[model samples]
Target: MDKLRDFLKSWPGRILLILCLSPLALLGIESYFHSGVDPNQIAQVGDASVSLNEYQSAVNNRRSEILENLEDASLLNEDVLHEQVLRGLVDRALLEQQAKKLGMTVSDDTINRLLREEAIFKDENGNFSNDLFATFLRQRGMTKDQLFAEFRNQLSLDQLNASIVGTAIYPMKAINQLIDLQLESRKVWLHRFNWQDYQQQVTVNDADVKAYYEANKKSLKSPAMVDLAYIELTPEMIKVNEVTQQEIDAQYQSFKQELGLSDDRQISQILLTGSDAKARADAIKARLDKGESFAALAKAESDDPSGESGGAIGQFNPAVFGGDAAAVEQALSGLKVNQASKPVKTQFGYQIFMVTSEGSSQVPSLASVRDEMVKRTKAYKQQTLFADKVTAINDLAADGFGIEDIASQENVPLKRIKNYQQDNNTSALSQPAVIKQAFDEFVIQDQSVTTAIDTGKSTVWVQPSRYRPAKTLSLTEATVKITQVLKQQKASALALKAAKDMAAKIKTEADINKQGISFQALGDTNRQSPLLSDKERSLAFSQPAPKNGVAAMASQTEMGATLIVGDAIKTQQQSQLSAIEKAQTAAIIRDNLGQDQLQDYLEYLRVIHKVEVNDANMASAQGR
Candidate 1:
């Protein structure tokens, strides 16, 4: 069980965890909209009924993970995979029931701890926030209570599984054996018998070639290939009307509203200060009311620092004015362009204000924004059209319409792709998701249209139009290959005989120097030696300890044969096992043994409580 848990904690396990927790569980993106399966009962374990929706969700999740990692997408079409996924769900249901029978429970405190410890639910200060946790649950279509309930149930099941497999105590003898195997090294004297020497002298004739071709023709064939008819819809394929005058006007209004602009004024003010500032301000306003220029009045008689530059202040809204400015705001709002106001008291001081510039916020005209509006309108319409078409196509497919029928009704062109194979592909349908759907059991065997598959950039529907089975190669076409094969076979036979003769001579003489064979001495080589083939190295280890440094025996490799004379098997002393190494080895042993124990317990539970599945309902569930 520890081994299984460790595996689940790895990259693949994390992916599975995400799937189980994610809303709709690996029905992929398109499934987010129409992921529901029928809720009818499909299987039973003891008193528990596994619903069609639940089984389908499990299968979809597991299948998605397998297809993502597996190099060949075609394997997704296998019925055995469907069976395995269903069985896994059934087993899980059985285990849950067993856990309940044993009265396993997870406390509320434990649940709270789990939620608090989850880093995703934390704020910048690393404290758990109820708002963030609630938001997370809401996004995944779950209420806080529902998520906690499920999490509690999961914890109970985990405890149950863990309890069945106690800490494993691996036998000392087995541990020693594994340790020795890992550390052992060998010193060897090796001999080589090269097959290339015999290859140059071997001869093949036309009859031999013909016989070889006749015997092996069936094995030389191409894999099964398929041709496809598919309808693909992308944003680029959407055609909509050009931007009209009305559309541009509406968009401009929307843009203006989004910007939230307001009318603003640019002001110039001469602030007066000191004990008699109010009186001074009133006198300044009187002078401004006269024919005196405001800038000249500000430059000569103003008491504030801004008086030097005619008291100019940049354009701003009333809200942008700072401090106890209620009176200033009211005064500024009433003034017109190029108009002066009476003295107004402010946080800084009493001031006389003039409005130099005023403007109302307005949207840009059509001509100035024509090109950008056209682009945005086009993109918006295309997206709307693409989404509508995708929905329509999916609806039609669900209603028993073929892709061709949908294409015709929706005014989309149906394109055909030829010679599609698992590895050799040339179409956009070559995408793994497309390939998986095209070869799905229902798509090929039952002749059904696939569910609308969104490929991020495009949505696609596939129908298999033609299927070709693999066929044997003709003898006439295989002659050249057969000739080479025959020569290799004859050469290998001759080489084997030579090797045997050489081995016999070496054993009798107890020496490797004879029969034109050259030997190299490898000192203290381990199993991972790059100089030798895996088979050769393993064979060297199997040889008995050398008798007075003589070659033990000879063995065969793929392309050649060899003999090894071993000096001794060198291994680490038992006391040399480091503390960390011992702990790691013990953990591995425990995990291995624990896994076996868990499997046995699960099997025992299955027999004690009879489990049943309905095949007919399973098939019907898949059809949905």
Candidate 2:
């Protein structure tokens, strides 16, 4: 406990402690500080409240998680996301209250068990990996401390549902009933009506269309829209910078030195010391260059113990050496048997090297590494270019430059999108935030260009030509839509009316054939039966089991209406939901019931606490 408390005082431990306690401890902590609700609070549940600041932080984090997982960020629905985050905070608030009331908090052992279950924290063999922990932190741009904090934070959030999971119980009878309902199979006879059959009979004039338009015109209003232009920037869009031969050659030289590539076999070294060592070694090399004997020079004036034996060293087998073996080997690499190399520096001071015998080089040829060198060079250059271009675009936008000018300078095409609206995109620029960011940054601002909107893999800047807030569109603008809707409604009414008329006259399954109704027989279909559409299957199972007669019902669909007739219903037992099988299924059902209980508990808490959510403030939070 002392160790744990001391660790908690460390930066990362403190962060983790904060993560575990935050907004939650804040749930009711503020009540002790102030009596009235804070103006920034987005929701209030009992004495607990969700502040706008906390909600915004969650939104940003959720958005980042979503964007990271998405291939295309444009598909994100901001409104749905906004509501999702808000509801989560609200539910979390309720859970926090219940957990505190029940004195339910996760224990250290429980946390450890839960952490082991999380795959991210474990390696393939299922043990906690410190390297993987560091990697996960790096990927999320977090420090070790923050990740530590996050781990505890995750446990705290999970613990919020302690009351729900612990208290929720599924009655044996209820579980059995669920199994019966879920496992029940029905024999269905499906009659699909062709829309064309009813279309020809139903006629719609201008007056009929006008009446339908007035009733549903609110939905017919044109979406909040913007006519805009934007430039999308992705790393792939940047041209790869060139790699010069000089650079490749330099890298090759480095590779050769590092690998100690050499053709020299039987080698010799003359070790020396002092600042004048290079001068002396150069003088000896000059004498050797003038055809003097290298062994004779080594014998007369070398510091190495091998000097008495003419400084001979064995072939490059990593044996004893006068100085650095790799350095000596590299120096001896270029030397012929009778020749001496220029002085090479070593920790022993300076040394001269010579090869006494010939052998094949251990070093690979230039051609062997040229392709790799080129690829590495190009990749590095491309990355730098991408970063530079993105920075330049951001700077230009900051400097109040128009998007067109910035696009032209960057040499990317400026694409235009007309009447772009939320959840309705016609062009390739689909990231749901494009319009939102555009409206938020460029719409109200006097500026023409939006700030750089980064989606991790890509960035974009939008310039709106016109902005149209959501409003009721004129009759002329919505006439075509209204006409299509009226036509569909009139046709559906006709189909249902005809199907009902036919049903009233039919008395049994035999009468169906007399009425010229042809139904395809679907045998032994369950709730998840692929043979029937969802509506068709629902109608099939919802009707009571026919004791002696047929049960029939009509429902409208896009293809027209379906006339479902049921003559049999059977429970799947012995073969499917056997006694043992039902027990196993009951376990899963119980878990689901637990989740349902959690939702119901949250709902109950909301009602009792007089929970209130400020939508206007929610919108403001979303805008941020």
Candidate 3:
């Protein structure tokens, strides 16, 4: 008894014992002590005993799967583990209950067949590999029977879920309609109103300013603030000296060799113009065949902007031409001297080529490139060193060292900022992590304790010198600001009303026609209309057109007139639904309206099952 008491005092020992005993209590004391226990004895449909061993196994399996898929071992967190396990247990229970309700059953034959064909259990010849199957089970620390049982149970539960959710499908007409909507394009003329144009005319009175200030006093209240000291390490400041001329020459020679420019081309061009251009081009090709000067012909006949300067196209890599330059490359592939290419027709027009000379593509030695590398390497090393230094400083602060001591030791200047908030308003702090750490340290019971935190680019040590509680605004201070907001809202309402009145004045299509404006019918403009601005698009679809009058508004730019659809368009769309869509749409409407019915059904199941959770076990699992 004394030993048991001592064990219970220890956190880990207490947690393990509690978890192990809870399942036994739920399954009954006798069954808990027995060997070769029946898994079903832990739970029935309604109230089930969730075994600690089973839950742990499930968590391990899930964790392993996540690690494999993410290829990252460091992603594991206790909170995530707890949440996933709890969710899995709850979902498993729900599925089991659903399976029982549907009378779904799994037999040994079904389990065997599924296992044999599961791909994981199959050999190269497509035959069931019993050894592979056994190995996989062994890896998971499960016996063959245990694995089979779990597989069978899961299959039954899956069938039950499928029956409830049903298959998702879209009819041909719906698919076609979706496709058309995606592909359809819209043409629109847009006019914009500049706010700057109206800003000059808007005047602020003394009363207006006072009212605005009063109403917005709460918004202007100072937020919770923090002050922090940080150190930043960056690579760009690192300096490298003493690069030799020999090194520079070596690098230049290496770069030159790598360029391999000796075999590159410098060619001239000419473009034949006008409607009979093809015929003129053929004639030019014939002259080129007769060995006329290619450069002279390009200068005389080519309409290219580069026709001057003897049509010099300059040097180029032959590999970049792809198949279009295949003949030119082949002809000049082994040419060591200057060569001209036969006329070739390209999509742009006809082209000629020339190979200037041959060159090597060798690169310089590492010794040659070492000077530039040293500068870059120095910067990289400096940045890394700076990060490590900052981390050490943060560690010192976290261990309760003062920021002043750190700054003095590191020989870095430390500045104290006042009236700063740790929240989103702390934009002036420069180092966000420093501010955050300061706020976190300040909130603790120990007022003198300092902490170090990462400020993204640097590490900071924060010491909270003082703490301030939040303050609410006085009513007198808030009044002026409120009045300004109210006034602006009133102005907006009036503007909207004026726009609507203008829209009403244009009653018919005749009004638009009489105004000399052409009406372009937009047939079933769905979500993809490019002509509509975001706000206009949303309003157009949602509000539609009114029946009696035009819904006109000044364009967003305040430069032109605009109209929203009136009642006739809305009526037409409603009447245009096909029979099948109409039926499906009605069913959707019914389902949305009858969501309460589904909730009631789930509630009825809960009552019949009498579900219970072992709160002690859950708490133990959560390390609470």
Give me the candidate number with maximum lDDT: 2
TM-score of predicted model 2?
0.65
Lowest-sum lDDT 10-residue window in model 2: 26-35
Q: Determine which window of 10 residues in candidate 1 has minimal summed lDDT.
A: 25-34
- Best-fitting candidate, measured by TM-score? 2
What candidate 3 gets wrong by more than 4 Å, as runs, is: 1-108, 134-157, 167-387, 411-444, 447-466, 469-471, 508-526, 529-535, 542-624
Q: Work out candidate 2's RMSD over C-alphas.
A: 9.2
Which residue pairs overlap in candidate 1's backbone?
1-594, 1-595
Across 1-624, the per-residue lDDT of candidate 2 in tens digits comes to 553465467544444554533322322111111235577888887887878777777667667767678876766878887777777777766765566675655455654565445555666687887787676557757765544344444445456654456566777688788777777886666777766677777777778767877887788777777778889887777777578865665566666667787444777777777888878887887887898777788888688788888889766653454435555555654455667777888777677778787767656545666798787667666777877887888889888888889989989899888877755655566566676776674354554777777664688888876777778867778788777776777788788777767767655778767877577877667888877788877877777745777777788877778887777777867655667877777777776777888778777888877788887887677665
Alpha-carbon TM-score of each model against the true structure = 0.52, 0.65, 0.47
Q: lDDT by residue for model 1 over 287-398, one digit each (tens)?
A: 7788678888888877877788988876644444465444564466557777888888877678778878866754354456768777777777788778888888888888
Q: lDDT: which is higher, 2 or 3?
A: 2
Compute the lDDT of residue 183 as modeled in candidate 1: 77
Query: In terms of lDDT, which candidate is stronger, 1 or 2?
Result: 2
Give Cα-based local distance difference scores for all models.
0.68, 0.69, 0.51
How well does candidate 3 match the true structure, expressed as C-alpha RMSD?
A: 21.7
Query: Model 2: runs farther than 4 Å from truth?
Result: 1-61, 77-163, 186-191, 245-373, 441-447, 454-458, 497-524, 544-553, 564-567, 577-584, 603-623
**Stretches of model 1 off by over 4 angstroms after superposition:** 1-39, 59-84, 106-152, 188-524, 529-537, 550-567, 572-577, 616-624
Candidate 3 matches the true fold with a TM-score of: 0.47
